[model samples]
Target: MVVDDSAVVRGLIAKWLGDDPAVEVVATASNGEMALKNLAAADPEIVVLDIEMPVMDGLTALPKILEHSSEIQVLMSSTLTKRNAEISMRALSMGAADYVSKPESTREVTTSLSFQQELVGKVVNLAAARRLQKGGKVYKAGKSSSLNEDILPQVSSRGAIAKRKMSSTLPRIIGVGSSTGGPQALLKFLNSVKDELRLPILITQHMPPAFTNILAEHLARASGLPCKQAEDGDVIHTGHVYVAPGDYHMIVVNEGGKKIIRLNQDPPVNFCRPAVDPLFASLAGTFGSAVLGVILTGMGHDGLKGSQDIVDAGGTIIAQDEATSIVWGMPGAVSQAGLCSAVLPLDDIGAKVIDITTGEAL
Candidate 1:
């Protein structure tokens, strides 16, 4: 289902989506009220909802839509702006699956290759997840043992964790990578561990400039910690959280016997400028065995190579389990590669981090 006030925009999205044989444009509506009226007949698995609309807006309609059908996945669409970013983040917390920054001009949306790809890709992925849920085969954390063997042969349950002695040296820094469902997961993790964190934390969330800035603000408020977008020459400090700014690769460098943040616009890695690989690799070089790397829910395998570097450097890597992730791609890649020391559900991740850092567990 596609919901937008402009008929042109609706037609454009519908046409683009129609081109993909894998997806079916079941319904279209100009407002939230019309969309609700068509819900039972359309029975869409995924809904592309515009943030600004007549009768009712995306933020107002989000929870109501979900209430109508708990299985429906709503993807909020909005023009890139600080207000939209804030609303989109709120939508995610309120049960919207994900969000996309649409081009300001509706006419240009269909013609833009990047926009088309992002829209189509998210629809396909979210729709498939809904199908999996309907078929009773959806993945869940702590229940990996019950997953279909053919679909996830490489996945291991918590009981299968490899035995290894944790280093006596505690982690001096923590690094996190996430995409897709990152905002909600980050909020939960940060809020849980903020009081126990003893070192500065670095986060690489796939987002653009305005959105990243807003995300840092939202995180700071949620976690009650000092969180901000990383600056080029800022010195790393304990008990602060730094988020990688958009369109730049954030890495750490040791200068004058102190670790400092470095932002680079040097080409993208894994099709992401603020990619996780660079951050993990840099941390590997700086802290070696004293670094803790976390891989969270995301759409692709961006963190796999960087996680390998962390493991090779004797650093500990923990991944969010498939069941708990919105999309299990990033963490799944690391888990499949047999690199993570622990594969935990989202709820357990914070406690586990505290245990590892406090010398209570490996």
Candidate 2:
């Protein structure tokens, strides 16, 4: 099943998946409601979901799909944006298997060159993983202790947490890379920390244009921090958050006496325009030991090389633990490569970041 409001998008996805002999383009819907209706009958083995649409969007349809058919694997199709990235991340938390970013929404059907290959591969693997009844186990990196649900710290309430002091004044930069389950995770982490956060934050979430502005607005509302799409010549300053825009690569470069943000429209690395490698690589070169690279819940290995870059530069790297991740591919890669400084669950990540930032631990 393919659920997208755009007829062109639906048709193009249908055509691409149709090429697989092991899979069939079972159904296509212009919106979530229609998709649900079709799903009631088709009982598709897998669903390709689009994040935005009229009348019951993907975010709303996500749980319904899982409730109606727990076995149905869903692969989300999302545009690049801070908000969409958040919603896509929400879908994953609600049980989406993985997601792909569609650069444009038009009848002419222009997409990133690797769109078909990447999307099809994710669908096939997701379908297989679901059929295997693995439950998030497909993303477990190189086998460790089989995780129990207790790995994630339980919060007493939505806004309840033990308060801790920001202890250190290290001149450091925070680099966060997320994909499928990033937005919600990011919000939770950012909001949990105090408004007077001390370090500068740089982010590369899989997203496209127009959405970054919306995301920054949303994050500002939630985290009380100034967040915006990083401009090419913008100066990097403490207490601010800079997000990598869609369709461009964001990197940090030092000029004169200060480090500034730089944007590039070059070809994608690891098939991602705002690939984590460029940002991490640049930070490794610029900040060296004064960087803390974090790879969070996401699909694929975009941040793996970046983790290596940070580690080699004498910086610390943190990976989100598998049980709390929407998809563990990115973090898993870093963990498997032994490039991590710590592996933590979602609830504990914020506290850990604060600890590292301030050099105080509770």
Tens-place lDDT per residue, model 1, 79-136, is 8777888998888767677887899886677567887777876786665544442343
Cα TM-score per model? 0.87, 0.72
Model 2: which ten-residue window has the lowest total lDDT? Answer: 147-156
| 1-362 per-residue lDDT for model 2 (tens digits) | 99999887788889877876546787899989998899877879888999889998988888888899756768888876666777765565456766787776563255555787778776765553333223423323222122222222121122322222222234389999987667767787787665548889999987667556556667777778988888899999888999998888999999997999999999998778889999999999998877888888776678888878877777788888866776666776777677776788988887788878777642
Candidate 1, pairs of clashing residues = 139-323, 140-323, 141-323
lDDT of candidate model 2 versus the reference = 0.74
Give candidate 1 regions above 4 Å deviation.
106-114, 128-167
Clash tally, candidates in order = 3, 5
